[model samples]
Target: MKYTPVQYKVNATILIKSEKSGMLSELSAFEDLSIVKNNNKEVENEIEILKSRPLFKNVVKKLNLNYQYFAKTKFSKRLVELYDNTPIKIIFKEDSLIVDPFANFIISIHSKNDFTITEEGYDSIKNGVFGQVISTRIGSLIINPNPDYLDSFIENEIFLSIKPVMDIVEDYKSRVSIGLVHQDANVISLSLNTTVKAKAKDILNGLVEEYNIDAANDKNQIYENTASFIKERLSIINTELSDIEQGVEVFKTSHNLTNVTSETELFLERSSENKKGVLETNTQLGLVDFMNEYLKENKESLLPVNLGFSEESIIRIIAQYNETALRRDEVLKSTTLKNPIVIRLNEKLQSLKLSLKQSLDNQKKTLKIKLKDLQRQDSVMNAKIASLPKKERELRDIVRQQEIKETLYLYLLQKREETAISLAATVSSAKVIEKAYSSKNPIKPKKRIVLLAAFMAAFLIPIMILFFKDLLDVKIKDKKEIQKKLDIPIVAEIPNTNTKGNFIIAKDDRSIVAEAFRIFESNLKFLLSESNNQTKTILVTSSITGEGKSFISANLSIILADPDKKVALLGLDLRSPKILEYLNLESAKGITNYVSDKNLNLEDIIINLDNIPNLDIINSGIIPPNPIDILKSKRLQELFVKLKSQYDYIIIDTPPINLVADPLLLADYVDLCIYVVRLGYSDRELLSVPENLYKNKRFSNISILLNDVNINSKKYYGSPYGYGYSKPKSWWKF
Candidate 1:
């Protein structure tokens, strides 16, 4: 058999996981597996080929495996670790290498506090040490601990106890460590030996008077206390002086002294001269100096010289007075506005204002010229307007026309409002449902359709299945198909059995084959009785050879030959005659020989099977080369007529209609032609030939005998005994 590739659609319901619900949802769609050739071949073979291929089978297996995995592990732990920054690792059994550095780092820093150092104090110095070290060690392998890491280490043993000690050392080094120093050799000599002794004596007198201590009592204690206090005060003064000196050094460093101009050097010279005079005067000198310079010069002596103030007190008073005078002088100087840069700027600003006033006057003259020109244009426009008609009759006409248009527009607007109101109130003229819920029985799969489908499949699947089962089993399975194609009716159906007995009439009536003969007999009686003229010559034929047409004829003749009527079974298949062998009769003289010889009569070749009373058989004595031409001859018609008169019913088994034209030629001479159609053995497409014959009025009587129908096959229909057919164990096995 030849096969053609055909596209077949298959539908399946598959369960897919829902992304939102994380559960299975049913999905259904048709899929085109592939195009396949199906020329009477087994469907199981195609399924097996599809299942064996790696592409489809692997996909199916992977889907099933994934589903099973999901069932076992509902949550993907790997996915959680990926997004949540959780510390986790898949450790190889052999070696414990850290696979993920980022995860490990997160785990290490999870509990560490974010620390900040104070701007002033030991904390700052400690931070500075680490900062400097980190700056130096960057781009190198050394791990200078960051604030968080250091805090973590400090909280643990060994590092925690040493942290405070390290902080103190770092603070000390930062405060006192000076790496280098330079000295300047310049010096100023001062006549300060006698002055220092006088200042010390004066300070001692003030301490004795202030505390009311006797000058003679505990001199050492007073000296010691005075010296200690003075030394402490001097130390504080020295530190302050050192900070001032450092500021001067910073200024000198920022502005190089070597780069100073002559004018800057002169300014520094004047400042130094003023400082020298102040130092030479000894601002803390005695009251004698003050009185000599002030009261003594005026010759005004105090009332009691003994009550006069001490030299230090007088110097302190004079210093306070000088400080007040100096502060007053500074205030006077700022208010007097004698600064050279400010005076110069004021003078230049005054000169600029005078020049700007002169320039503004000149520009005013130019602006007046342009203003006069604009005034002239304004006058021209006024003169032109004055020259036009004062009443403007055309303007009045336009105004009158606009008023009329406005009135007409208002009228139209009112009409539109009326139309809109009418539309709103109008009834809606449309159909509305009166009875909404008219109930109806749901139409689903029809039982009649299912049963008919089962019957048709039962009739056809076996024949198709048998054709694919083996290549050489050529047999007819349906009688109606043969009748329709050959333009005839079914005479009988013969059951297949392994008995090798003489052709016997079914009188005992207990066998299945005998029951089938009865059915044929009943159909024949109905067919003949309904006709205007009884059909005596019935020709049984098939589409092709080996369709059991001869078997049907012989058995049908036996069933029809009752004690009341005569029946003759004629073997007219001249190409191959198996009737003589079937009946155990010798093919000595038969229809073929009688047709060839002009003097031969039907009586010379007729034989009777003893098992069937009133049943006679005419077997083909010899094979003929031109069976069609012999069947078309006038002698065959005369032979059929003679047998029609002698027999109540003559069943003639002819050759296959599709293989030869003998059946068609013989169909014209027979009273009724019975076509034998084998069910499983017949092709569905071949049924069209018989259908077309009937549609074209080839013969009047026609019926189908479905044969070889397998009632127990699921491919056909469910078994009558309800024994469920099991799926082929290796349905998809290749």
Candidate 2:
């Protein structure tokens, strides 16, 4: 047997697994090659050559492999010698004609030996005695077996061991038996010979029955079962083969590799040796072809065992399949879907068809009636238009008016339709709440907002009350109010002094309140100072009862008696003599007796007070029903002229202006008039009387005094005379 030594080198690029990212080492080297080609040229050359082939190109295309390189370097010679010193080889037996030299030796000798030297002796040598034969052993013996050479032997042994067992198991002819015996003398007293004889008989009978059953089933039945199974297996194999072929074709078409070989050939024809040429060729063939060819030629010995398509190739195949499927779906969608215009047209057509059908029904129902009405109206209009002159201007005007009315009616009908639609579309109605309430901020008092609220209240309260009174009724209340409303000045303001320490007759001048009486004194002073008349007697009256007539008369008389001036107070209201009680003086004879008696003189009836040096008082002598008639006599006017040179200032308090006629009648006698207006006690409406008397020029002189004023009232700062007023403190420290 002859054998040829064939050396197959596999460039296994093994990479150590990195612990950090669970990946193979980035740096790897091929053991067979010193200079690693980590460039596109190697991958491109492989891809181009493989793409030119038919069978391998289709498989490469289906696998979708890619060519990728890693940097490689050779170890130094010294490093290689130190680390990789051992030479590893495998030798195996082939056919006799191709025997391996290393395996053909039956015995391997470790030491050199001479072939001529036999074990017994060298004298019995046939051809050349005493000549030594060189031994052919070159190295030590080591037990090594090649895995490729032992594969057939190992597979054959496995098949042989499993085939018969599988056949018996499938045929159901295999059986298992167990034998049992009691050998203890204490437990079983039977002899050993008896026990063995009984067990042997049972075993012999069981084995004979099983063998007879197998023999009766025969090999023909087994052959028939085996043939049936083989036929089924062959059918499945054929089906699987057909499916694999169809899958291959599908993969080729999906990856665009059906004509890869022809395409690669064409590419190589146009290819140049430049970088652009190589890159263009590789791009045309794709990554799969490049990697497949690289693994095949560079690691051919390891191809069937360890090499396969890379992960990048599988990803490319899946991506391409998905893209193709998506495109197909898009095409199907565009072709099968209905157009929007067609759908809208169909909907409108259906609606119009329904409307047309309804119109036909309506026409059937109303044709006769409508035709009769139209004929009658047409006849009437035709007769009317025919009666008009053809060129007449009035006819043209009539026609134009008819046309305008017709157009307006049509326009109104259309507008009515639109309005109906709008009304139907409206969802809600609006309601008003309070008509906006005049939209003004009411003016109210805010003390913190302003410092003048108190001042405004003092003046505004009285004005507002009067305004409100005017709104309620037209009656007058007081002479001063009437005067102010009528825009006239007051005639007088009598001072109110009715206390004991300030007590006086017509001549006393010891009261401090009497100082207030000087205001009236000053008014009369100015009045008489300007006037030529020197009348001293004055009649005081009021319009009603309790108008302070006596009080005013007494205080006026006391105020006038200053520095030896003579003055007297007289009770002119003969029906009610309040002067005696007010002055603390008792009189047996008063003004009535004095006036009625013929011989009465001023010294006979006048009473004097100790404190007032020049003042005196005259009480009304007796109560009389008709004091007016007595006062009206000529003696009274002559008596008033008789006291003309007696005093400097004289005053008379009369009945209220609204209640009596006496004050009005005596208006001519008095040289000066002083009106008293009591705050809060006097009615504001009665003020017009005094005001009107002053406006009519009925008094020689008139002035007003607000009486009984409370100095502690909130209206004033501290006193009625404006004393003790102070500014407010600063706010920051508080």
The best candidate by lDDT is 1
Q: What is the TM-score of each predicted model, taking all chains together?
A: 0.33, 0.32
Q: Which stretches of model 2 miss by more than 4 angstroms?
A: 1-483, 486-512, 535-539, 714-717, 720-734
Report the lDDT tens digits of candidate 1 across residue range 1-734. Answer: 01211112111111111222111111111112111111121223212222222222233222211111001112332211111111121112213322211111111212233212222212321122221221111111112334422443332211111112223323322322111112221111111111123222222222212212221122222223323432443354356545555655565566443343455345436544433332222221222333334333322111111112323333333333332322233233324547664455445444433443343344344434544554455345435444334333223223333433343334334333333333233221111111111113212234566679989999899988877875654444344435444544545455544355544545765555566678788877877776564436677776776657767777778788889889888888888887877666776789889899988888888897677769898887788888777787888888877877787887878777777677666656565556556667776556665666567656555555555444334434322222232334466764
Tell me the whole-model lDDT of each prediction, alpha carbons only: 0.44, 0.41
**Candidate 1 stretches greater than 4 Å from native:** 1-505, 532-535, 711-734
Error of 2 at 69 (Å): 99
What shift in Å separates residue 430 of candidate 1 from its native position after superposition? 87
Q: Model 2: per-residue lDDT, tens digit, 1-734?
A: 01211121111111111122111122222222111111111222222221222222232223211111111123321111101111112121222212112212211212122112111222332211112222322222222322333332221110000112223222212121212123221111101111122222322233333322332232123223323432443354346545555655565556454333443344324432322332332222222333244334532111111111223334333233222322233233324326663344345444533443344344433434544554465445445445444433233334333433343334334333333332233211111111111112212233344447667888999999989976876433334444456554444543334354534533333333454567666766665676676546555654455555666677667667777577766566566667778777766676677778879886677777788877766666787678678668776676566556665545555556676565666666787665665655666666666777778888876656555544334543332242233234478744
Candidate 2 C-alpha error for residue 692, in Å: 3.3
C-alpha lDDT of candidate 1 relative to the true structure = 0.44
- What TM-score should be assigned to candidate 2? 0.32
